[model samples]
Target: MRDAFVRALLREMARDERIVLVTGDLGFGVLRPVKEQFPDRLLNAGIAEQSMVGLAAGLAATGRKVVVYSIGNFPTLRPLEQIRNDCAYHGADVKIVCVGGGFVYGSLGMSHHATEDMAVLRAIPGVTCFTPGDPAETEAVVPAMFQTPGTCYLRLGRGNEPHAHEEPVPDWRFPKAIRLREGRDIALLSAGGILVELKRAAEKLAEAGVSAEVVSFPCLKPLDREAVLSLAGRFTDLITVEEHTILGGFGGAVCEVIAEAGCPCRVHRLGLKDEFSAVVGNQAYLRHLYGIDGEAIAEKAMALINEKRTDAGRNP
Candidate 1:
């Protein structure tokens, strides 16, 4: 996914001379091509995250489109004040790109985990939050952020993530939830690289005689409310899954939509609880530990399905 993001970013930079790539001395392996092609446009901020963001804001103020890239909390939580004040408050055309969201850096411990970035960034006014599900979604999101005229946040996974979309999305735009599969028993929604696990859970649910619909949410802020409401009205059970904490994350966004519309679906949010990760493990293991893994998703869906059955039996 990081490879695809860099490729798309390089493509955007090629045409737009105003676009600049600034980093906190990270992503050397993935950003090598970017540095080679646009030698003058790239800036190595050298681990100074706050200054890197502030510099991007100043550059954007001078009519340059800036993209600040770093892993996890380095470009976000570390430089939040600059982002909220310089970028978001000013409505600067600065794209804050974060790689290794959620537990992608779990082995490095909670400090490297970007579990709160989406909520933190989204809280700022005028900042767009994007969490792409796959390489194709990443490709779609970069161009959209470039065209958008204010601060934007791009939350990315590690790399080598399988393509979730079976085919290309035609005329895709930001803040629109993409429906991957359709079913009536329950609806499953996911964001970022977590979509893969949701898809797996959908298959598992199918084997267990439960039909599930899958939707991928790439854009969290300015969420596709109509899409969310459409599914909520159609399905009795709607479950939102994400790599970040359930509070104020993708699930929170979906719940807001459902609540506003008064949709009939009973919503279940699956994500990390309100605590730091204590165990050191890989991404998959961490997700399971939080009970937000693929099988966990299936279990949550089955519980909801059983509840509906029990209610019907009692009423009948």
Candidate 2:
């Protein structure tokens, strides 16, 4: 997925000399091609995330397209003040990119986890938040980031995630949700890197005689509210899945939309609870422990389907 980000970014940089890539001493190997091809446009900001962001903001203010890169929470959390003040407040065109979201760096511990970044960044006004589901979405987001006019957050997953979309998304300039699989019983909505697992869960739901619709929310902020409202009319249950905490995260974003629409649909928010990981070994193990994995998602979907059936039988 990181490769997809760099590849698209490289293409954009080749055409636009105004673009600059700044890293906080990370992505050396993965971003090698970019560095080799455009040495002057690329910068290593050492280990200072805050300074790197401040510099990016300054560059953007001068009519330059600045893309700041780092891993885990370094890009978002470490320089949050810079993002909120210099970038977002001014609507500067600084694209803050973070790799290894969630527990992708589980062995490295909680310091490397990025479970709360979505909620934190989205709270800041004038910033666009994007969590591309796979290589395709990552590619689409790159060009979109270049075209967008304000502060942006691009949350990237660990490399080698499964492809969720069949082709490049249609909307490169606007923010919206993309529908994957169609069904009537339930709709499984996912944001960020979790779409891969969410797709697998839809398959499990199919085998269990439950039809599940899958929607990928690559754009977190300014969520595809219209899509959610339309889906509410078709499905009884809307289950939101994300790697972040349920509070003010992807799930919370959907809940807000549903609440305002005053729809009769029930939304089940599936994610790492409002707590940190109890134990960690790897991304897979940690996701399983949190019950946000594919199997767990499938199980939760089934429970919702069955419960709705029981209610129908009693009411009828």
User: What tens digits encode model 2's per-residue C-alpha lDDT throughout 1-316?
Assistant: 8989988998999999999999999996998998789999989999999889999999998999999999999999989999999999988899999999888898888888899999999999999999888888889878877888889999999888778877777665457788889887889998898887888899998998888899988899889888889998888788999888999999999889999989998889998888886576798888888888899999998888788789999999
What residue pairs are clashing in model 2?
none
Report lDDT (CA) for all predictions.
0.89, 0.89
Poorest stretch of ten by lDDT in candidate 2: 165-174
Model 1 Cα lDDT, one tens digit per residue, 121-176: 88999999888898888888888889989999999998886778877666787779
lDDT of 1 at 245: 87
> After TM-score superposition, what is the CA distance of residue 124 in candidate 2 from its true location, in Å?
0.2
